[model samples]
Target chain A: MTKENNKVTVSRRSVLKGAAATTGAALGAGALGGFPTIWAQNIKNVTLRQFGTGVSNLNDVATKVKEDLGFTLKMTALDSDSVAQRAATQPKSFDIADIEYWICKKVWGAGNLQAMDTSKIKNYDKIAGTFRSGKLTPESEIAQGTAPHTVGFVEGPGSKKFADNESGWMTLIPTIYNADTLGIRPDLIKRPITSWTELLNPEFKGKASILDIPSIGIMDAAMVVEAMGEITYGDKGNMTKEEIDKTIAIFIEAKKAGQFRAFWKTFDESINLMASGEVVIQSMWSPAITAVRSKGIPCVYQPLKEGYRSWGGGLGLSANLSGLELEAAYEYINWYLSGWVGGYLMRQGYYSAVPETSKKFMTEDEWGYWFEGKAAKGEIKTPTGKVLEKAGAVRDGGSFYERMGAVACWNSVMDENKHMVRKWNELIAA
Target chain B: MNNTISPEKTSWMLVSPLAFILGLFLVLPILIIIMVSFWDYNEYNFFPAFISENYDYLLTSKVTLDTYLKTFKFMILVWFFCTFIGFTVAYFLAFHVRTLPMQIALFLLCTIPFWTSNIIRMISWIPFLGRNGIANSTLISAGIIDQPLEWLLFSDFAVVLAFVHLFSLFMVVPVFNTMMRIDKSLIEAARDAGASGFQILTNVIIPLSKPGIMIGSIFVVTLVMGDFITVRFMSGGQSTSVGRVISNEIGLLQYPAAAASAVVLLITVLIMITIMMRFVDIRKEL
Candidate 1:
């Protein structure tokens, strides 16, 4: 009996030592694994290059790709148009592109991006059905354009071709999406600003700013034009030449009268404009509005009665992708849609493509707080674990589905995008 | 003489490395831009075909003309301010300071801000100029005004001020170099001949400082002409510059149009420089 007891104690001690050794090995591997050149000697390696705009949280997803698939994902951050320019003119520079829907349409027109095989994406069927379905609110129904999230596929293969089956292909995979609205400083405005026309209201003269980006800025102006009882666009996304001219003329008239304090060209500029009280109101991204609030400014990303201008970003395979590069690119896409990436992006005010899958990585409270718009059960933190919300703080737009599902119009590349850019330049010059 | 290489050949050898660098980086890119300016582009793609549509549209547009006038307006205003400030500071340092160490120290003080990022320096003015900023608050406390100054932050004044702050150093460096090189004997002779301070400055100093002023003018004029960020940020986007138009066009992926605008800007700047150059032989002076 004494010998048996001694043997049992020895086994228990050895098991504990083994567990400690494994943990230490994992920690060392993680540190050394960051160096691709050293690891490439022992492992079969592929470098998956990517170009994108507004994909900062993807650094974590790159780590996931390295651990799961033994590949190095190199991402280059660029502006929206730069990404399109590179994808269209130099598709060989990158294997994957994180681009907007309209950009994909533009690049796809140039036969630069390949159709994504959805069969390889394990979470394809589990992606939010509402996003894929073409159903729209009554406002959108009358608006007579596809919903922002309705990314249609061509049911085939190759660059331009696509398919909408379980095994079908698409030009891009839906990833991060959000609803955007005007961020307003209520303390300065000192009144309710419910309508988009308020962006142009003379009362706010020299206290309003808009984005300098032509494609997105024109849409915001179009919303204001309609809200101000001017002629409404048939489709705000793909406005006709007449519609664009009419909207730009309104903007030019307003600009001449000093309707804007500044035209912000970047996220930080927009935030600084509001935070420093340079502008009382401006078209702002959700994250920027959050940043301003974090600065202790009385800012609100208001849900205008005209509804939010929504947009989404997705991933596309470059036409130059082949062999191991192609296989690794697909693997990265699958891993990006996995639960952890979705959860990570959700904490940053973006809705994940596959919410059900993302829920696996998040607590029930996090789901309720982020998606259901419930008050935080405990302290809620950002992806990097900075305290974003204290207990009992509620989300701004109520629920993710309610906010994203009711988008008025998606940011688009209009049919008259070139003419629109000229008009936009004229407005700025004026 | 028969065995020795010609002066031209020796000079060419010395300049070849510099010529190669200039040709590779500068002349080649400018030529490519000129070439691309004539290319045709649609919404998505640019085609490498010779066409005058971009230049035609740019040259014909009223907006382009107005934008050029605005840019020229900014350039003239900024140049005047920078030259005046730069000359005063340089004169104080070069002549009045007297001690070499103090002059060098003050000169270094002027350039210390340049060691940091230009963007940071540009943005550091925001808090100072904002409506509720330190300047306004100080003024308000002093009973200088009842209301916070609105124009202090986001108007033409702010744009000019930011430019003078940034480009004044360019003027100072060149003007100071020339002032330091001016013969002290000449100024003493003018004073001995019963010249007043004003007379000495106007006749002896100003005439001798022409090369420095011309060089300083070149730097200031070119910098303000090429600048868009200061105007874009400081003027609250109410102002537009020629460079801003090119940048905007590029951002919109209108490469051909941007190239055309760039070509026009380059020609305009070159003409201005040539006119300035006629005022003083900068190469001969250097």
Candidate 2:
């Protein structure tokens, strides 16, 4: 019996030694932990590459949504245009991506995303009907989202830049969307500046800034051209190839005029340019408008008789990202569109896709001020008790939350993307 | 007779550990990277099958070649400038300096850039090259220029400046070491024989320092060839480089194309190093 025990002990000791040897080798190798390099071979987990700005804050939002459930969301930030291109070519790179409504139709046609799975989302039933089946919203639906829609104007010397009536599928969901209006420092370029012609006024020479971005920026220029009525693109969102050429010509003229003090790439750069007082008037975005207001500077979104144009962005799912992960992705999307999170996004200066969840969170006085455009009804506090003001409240698309979903634009590739980027470069150079 | 080991056997045994390490770390991964580059990236941007698409694009595309040309040009320019400046400074320290401590201090000064991280050193250049930077401010205040120059921070010249600042030390260390080894009697004898100072410096000092120059050139060229961050940060996306192109492809999750581009770069750098070795023995010099 003692001999048998000794033999058994030797076998056990050998097993322990083998285990330790393998573990030690792995530790010494500095083996990559849980690296999904192997996942490239495996088809189970889909990869997602999202391209945009504000990764720091978006990472926080992604964490909150992922932690609320057990889904793992692998997000990589990129340029908005680059995201559209990847979605255009490698549809499988991302199972889910956030794109602007302006680029929706073409991207969808490119087979980048699989559209609405209403079944996967249960609480989606709670969303307003206007957002479903596309457009046709009641006047009451205007203030339904988490944040009230604020009017944004086209490229002003000091104004915010918004996607106006220029064609292409609306790639953005239009959360923080603004209309094409003129923004001016009441201290510099005083009021009664109601039309597109004023943007070309020589008095503001070298004191204006415009977005250097080609696609949407051209659209804003087209709107101004349309407001002028002599130069025409013949369509709002739908333009022919010839129409695109004419629009480029009009933009080239402006570029040669040296009317702009600078062409900006980032939102912060625009702010810095404006703050330098070098640019007293320029096309701007909602956040910039809010920033100017917060500093107690007098800035106003000029109302135009011609309807202001706008653009938006929305969330979509991947075809391969089905089952629990897909369901989770949709849940996160629904929660985002469900008003609460949308309101939080809006309180920070954006429009919400869902208005109901955001509405309940808003006080009656707060609602009146933002929707009615009267005065500060009260110190509007968020769920976290943060104070925010309701400015840029007079949004033109009362049904903007619902009506903008018909948004879709096809992205051009190969020779076409080259042409677009080139045209933009020439426009800046000119 | 069998009790004593053969010299050949002893040598093999001694070299086996080094052979094993090189094979495992360098040879194996390189082979894998090359193999993977030839594969197709699937729905998840994962390598799955033997694919020609990645290579087809990288090899044939205009954008790829443009980036390669830009990268090569930048490498050559940076190498030439860095080597020239480094040799001058190193020559002064080695020949002109009177004290050994002073020489050591100057050598340490050459290495001061290494004391901090490469990234921090590069980024510190931004404040000095920005729109309202010190140079511009000084120029403006001194009435040398009217407005702030927007081209300073993000330009090809700026990229070169950063590259030289970062890498000049590689050239300095090798050249300085080479300069120190020259016999004083040889120089005196050359002078006594009526050889001019410039001639002696060129014929004796330069020819003798060929090995050191080769070693330093290889180091600087190889490093600058692989660098993308300095170009990317300095150029602000105005131009493209090989490393930047690879980084962009990686960002888009196009790993196969990125890997293929890396393979191409690896081959180019290898060819360069091989050419350098043909002229002089780098191993002996180092």
Candidate 3:
């Protein structure tokens, strides 16, 4: 039972004794919020918990609406999982949450959120039903407990699209989306490493990086394993144990060969690894490419012959609520899906479902660089003063967010995540 | 029974808060975690039932023990280094830094890190040793190194560096207090009785400072024993620490396995504390 010094105690959750010092501090501060007793008399408070891309902009818009639109909007910010976890536990923690779309079905299964009433927000109707699509078709035998409709969009690996028809081709709304590309340094190899095969190249030893998160990373590993015919994982969104083992073997073999420079836990680290040439190419997201391009480095997002993996994040509401709070929540959710918030996230190195609103905010040339995939029309330098003439995704299905409508991976649950993660660990530790 | 002298009944009220906290926060959850470790893991990261397989895999696997051994070895190395350095710094502050104001300032400086969140302090270390960090810039500017050191920020060395930085204060407070309370006249008497300054320090000061040294050691050992964040952050998730293992388990919602690791760590720390109490009462020593 004895273990090493670096063991993590139960500190993250219940291990936090002393009554959660941070929670206490927040409560203490909330006490002094100059909390208008008079204001409390007139206005009701609503909280919306969300994470990452949409947090700040959504908060700002919420504040604007509170001031001008006259709704006392109370918002709490948290990670993607926390949003779902809280809704599962204390149903009254928030009225709305910008949850990751894939998690929505999971939460709905746990009896967390109520079905989104479309009558509250007519805007939900005017927009494409693609945002409201679910993975199970209208006729699928997903126990009656599941939420039959999709609430909004989050970006992920691209797939097919269907109209009004509810099927596996359905997608949630376009949240902030981007492609997971192999960001490679041109100086490393004469020939571009555009395929998964390049990672197994003996020529470039100890010059790779991979994500440490097993969920997404294992999928990438399985993709490579299948491409190499070493493993075939993801059985209709469920990976068998054998398939997982094969993927693990491939990753383990790669590790033993000293193929990786290091592994990155965060988006920032991957960018730093790429920029310094420590890792020539690793599993990287669009933000990292945007960062490297800013540095005047010649790092290119090599559109693989196979395909770049993609991901997205967006919002939902607590199921327990309906009435006016629900209406206010729907407003916030739609505003998030609407141009203002989505557009802001898009221009800041993210692609939006509401591309039109985001483009309206961007300069004509900026729009061309991101969505149109055109080179800089005029002499322009990236945020880091790097000349990005042939800068953006050179491949046709670029702008990882916009194209996610065809992405089958968005919010789709793998049948066997445990086996998938176990396989992932085997791959990394191998 | 003499109420004041009886061990169990005398201080039950004094110990109630801790007992309650442990029962509610630590012991009870640990029990649940033990139950969870034997359950199944889903893609959504849920624990379903008692599927002896998770424990079966855990018990039968050699990698688990290997990771455990590496964690203990890391704790030993980290505890030794931090305690040694901590004793030295605390010694200088107590005996040498005679001015009260300066001592107060130094004490405050040691605690400055505590004022900020732990995460900020850990993250700040990254920039100092990162690819574009000061160490790399200074070396490159001095024409000492051409390329940024890939291993500088997320290596074993980096893990140790971060641990020492975080834990040194735990060492300093007790050692400094122990040194301050020593009879000043004992050193004077030793010097008067034909003893040199070094001998006086060695004979009187060193022996007297044991209480502080032991107390400080307990703090450092326990803290380093349980912390995984510094190592996890510094090593870029390559290295295994008991904390990392437990954290990964928790992330996958494997509560019982994580709990098992935690229980192991807690028991080890409690044993160390008990051993230290024999040399001197930690309460009086502090």
Which pairs of residues collide in candidate 1? A154-A162, A155-A162, A155-A163, A156-A162, A156-A163
TM-score of chain A of 1: 0.84
Error of 3 at A87 (Å): 5.4
lDDT of 2 by residue, B1-286 (tens): 7789989999999999999999999999998889889877532245468888777866776566666777788889988998898889888998899899999998887787698999889978866876667878988999989988765765678889899999988998888898899787889999999999999989888887888788789889988888877876665444457786666555434567678889999998999889878998766755
Interface RMSD of 3: 3.7
TM-score of chain B of each: 0.95, 0.95, 0.81
Top TM-score: which candidate number? 1
Every candidate's DockQ is 0.56, 0.06, 0.17
Query: Tens-digit lDDT track for model 1 on A1-430?
Result: 6675345434533543453455456557785454333333322335667778855435777787778777667778886767778877887788788888777766677777887777888888777653455443333342223343434465567635433433366667888878888889999988888889999989999889999877778888888999998977789988898988899899889888888888887777788899988899899988787677766677888878888887777888888776445766776788888877889888777888888888988888889998999999998877776677779988877898678766788778776778888888888888
TM-score to true structure, per model: 0.88, 0.62, 0.75
DockQ of 1: 0.56
- Model 1 TM-score (2 dp): 0.88
Question: Top lDDT: which candidate number?
Answer: 1
Residue A318 local lDDT, model 1: 83
Q: Which of 1 and 2 is the better model by lDDT? A: 1
Residues A1-430 of candidate 3: C-alpha lDDT, one tens digit per residue = 2352123232212323232344355468776454333234223333334333223334566666666435545556643334445544556565555555555544544444444444444345434323454332344222111122432321221321223333322233345655455677877666757577677666767677777766567656655666676664444234677766666777778777777767776667788788866678778776577677777777776767655455555554555554334555666556655565555554445666556656665667767766766665664444334555544434334643334433333323455665665555444333
Q: Place model 2 in a CAPRI quality band.
A: incorrect
Per-residue lDDT value at B41 in model 3: 49
Candidate 3 to truth, TM: 0.75
